[model samples]
Target chain A: MSRTKLDLWVGFFVVIGMGALLFLALKVGNLGGSNFTDTYVVMARFDNIGGLKVRAPVKSAGVVVGRVTNIGFDTSGYRAEVTFALDTRYQFPRDTIATILTSGLLGEQYLGLDPGGEAEMLKGGEVVQITQSAVVLEKLIGQFMFDKAAEAPAN
Target chain B: MNGLLNVVRLLGAMVTEAIWRTGFGARFFILLLRHSGQSLTRVHLTIRELYFSGVLSLLIIVVSGLFVGMVLAMQGYETLQRYGSGDALGVLVALSLTRELGPVVAGLLFASRAGLAVTAEIGLMKTTEQLDAMDMMAVNPIARVVAPRFWGGVISMPLLAALFSAMGVFGGWLIGVVLIGVDEGAFWSQMQAAVDFRFDIMNGVVKSVVFGAAVSLIAVFEGYDCTPTAEGLSRAITRTVVTSALAILALDFVLTSLMFRGQS
Candidate 1:
């Protein structure tokens, strides 16, 4: 009896450990375990992705509603194309602005959606027309320096 | 002058002898590895040892994880509040636990609680000639005894680490959201936004597994090599804890670099 009880407890311990591991993997790590919901793919094009990885969150007004499913570069167009696996529950207008954005200073880059004032909802196999590429600090700094230099000669 | 010269000579000989003994321990470890397949055959013993090492150590892992998490949330809130970003408390607590605190702290506790026990148990058996008696009975002590415990430690370390992180995250939630009045939604959502399943949590699991293997190796090696005396047994147990702690910490650094260096 005692041996059986001890074995039961050990089994219970292993179950709890595995449960915790699964929770961490799914909830905390923001991976699987919520894939039952059907999703729609929305494509967007950008000039720069700026360190965005596949599986980055797709947030709408600070609420995560989907994930980045794939990223590919349009070599001929010199643009980056991104595919989003959006939850079917939330529908965006056809002219929604899909912007590649960083959350915090030195943090991850994600896709932030801003709904536009359009009556027609986005359909499957359609592309989001408006896209704002990732902001490169170096480019902004270079532009600012060039502007200042251009003004210095005049002043 | 001659006496002082003799003292220096004695120190040099002691260092060389210590080095030689360590080499012997390394050889013993290789032999143990060669015979570790016996652990699979001794499944009953492995489960029994796992009960003692892993299940028995769960309480400490959970309690310590809770306290560490609470402290992390409290500290994180204070710091983030200074920057007016207290809503990011979940991200802070989760990142710290999953990356640094969870595996490292749980590993240290496992070393003290289970690793030391394994060492003392084995060392005492050696001192009392039980291991030799087993040998006389035509049983290989390393295969029959040590391998099960070694495998037990290796398996338990990662599980304990995961439990610690989970409990710690809950503790942080309790303190940050319930007691401290942080927005509960923001806490979890921020964490979900910031932490990556592959990057942060997976690397933490890998860290725990490596620490487990290294610490278990030390525990078995020290117990197997102790001088057969009461004092020697005690010293071996102490060395097991100390060496496991040091090895876990050092391995954490090397593993962290190798895991995260590519992302940056």
Candidate 2:
């Protein structure tokens, strides 16, 4: 192979390979693509968090505004507390409704925020008072079965 | 009765011979590793071998990648349609290609295309006395002949795999979005939301790298160990293909399990 030709092809090869890998990582995987590095952390409490994982997307208006940073048990309240860092660009009112939601019917759980009409704004470390817990599919099915059994005995 | 007894003895001898061959191959592989340092200084030779093994294999890799991706999209649509999630074709195709098929299929293709050629070229040189001539000239053939090709294969494998994956994803998009009636936004957005860079993409790169090392090791060792004869050279080339393919697949399985063990 000619020296220049070899160098040219090798350079092309390296560039394309790296480009594909970067596209797969940043575009397909959405890794390091999140622009929420500089953000504020807020916590919320739920009776059941279900399968809401750390790093799960926190969406507002169906657009990801932040990510779940941590999850812990609140021993005093006997509830699950979730902390998320919301990008400062997307300001939220103090009366925002934060609810746990699953993307698809059987997909990952994320925190969904619905802005409420409030003149005041939420600050960092502030707890969201209005929270909806995750829907426990298994528990719902068990309760449904118990209700059916109870009705059958009464009948 | 005598023939039956002879057959039993032959079987036992064959097993022992296979064990001996494995040991010899292992030693040869270790020697290649030792001589690999010489490859760093022989930049010209390494580049030449890379042209042969890497540049020459691009056409086949790209073509196969595109076709594989197209097929995946078509099949994925059929299956996903039942769930009324046909729009998620991009996610299905991307996940399958990047995580598993991309590295595995590309490694197999690389072995068939480049690994076999390395084996045959080396085996021919040995049979034709070029290697022995180098030895007489006070040159170490392993450093000059084997190490460059080994390095070339190792470097080329991952790049080829990445190219394959890219082409495959494009092919799938052509079919799923352009040809079929799937929602273009859902296909891409869902894929981005689901796959993880560290988990899926990095694991695939790791698999391809390990496969590259294993296949190149098998190829060089097979070529070096062959008897200096026409039949021996042909046998070495065939062995190179079969062994490298088997090694790639087995390594893919072991690596995949380890990478995804704790994942739900």
- In model 1, pairs of residues that clash are none
Model 1: runs farther than 4 Å from truth?
Answer: A1-3, A33-134, A137-155, B1-11, B262-264
- DockQ for every prediction shown: 0.43, 0.43
| lDDT, candidate 2, at A19 | 81
RMSD to native, candidate 2? 4.9
Interface C-alpha root-mean-square deviation of candidate 2: 2.2
Displacement of the residue B217 alpha carbon in candidate 1, Å: 1.1
Residue B186 displacement (Å), model 1: 1.4
TM-scores, one per candidate: 0.78, 0.81
Candidate 2 runs further than 4 Å off: A35-101, A110-134, A148-155, B1-8
Q: Going through the candidates in order, what is the number of backbone clashes in each? A: 0, 0
Cα error, candidate 2, residue B249 (Å): 1.1
CAPRI class of candidate 2: acceptable
If you score just chain A, what TM-score does every candidate get? Answer: 0.82, 0.81
Best by lDDT: 1
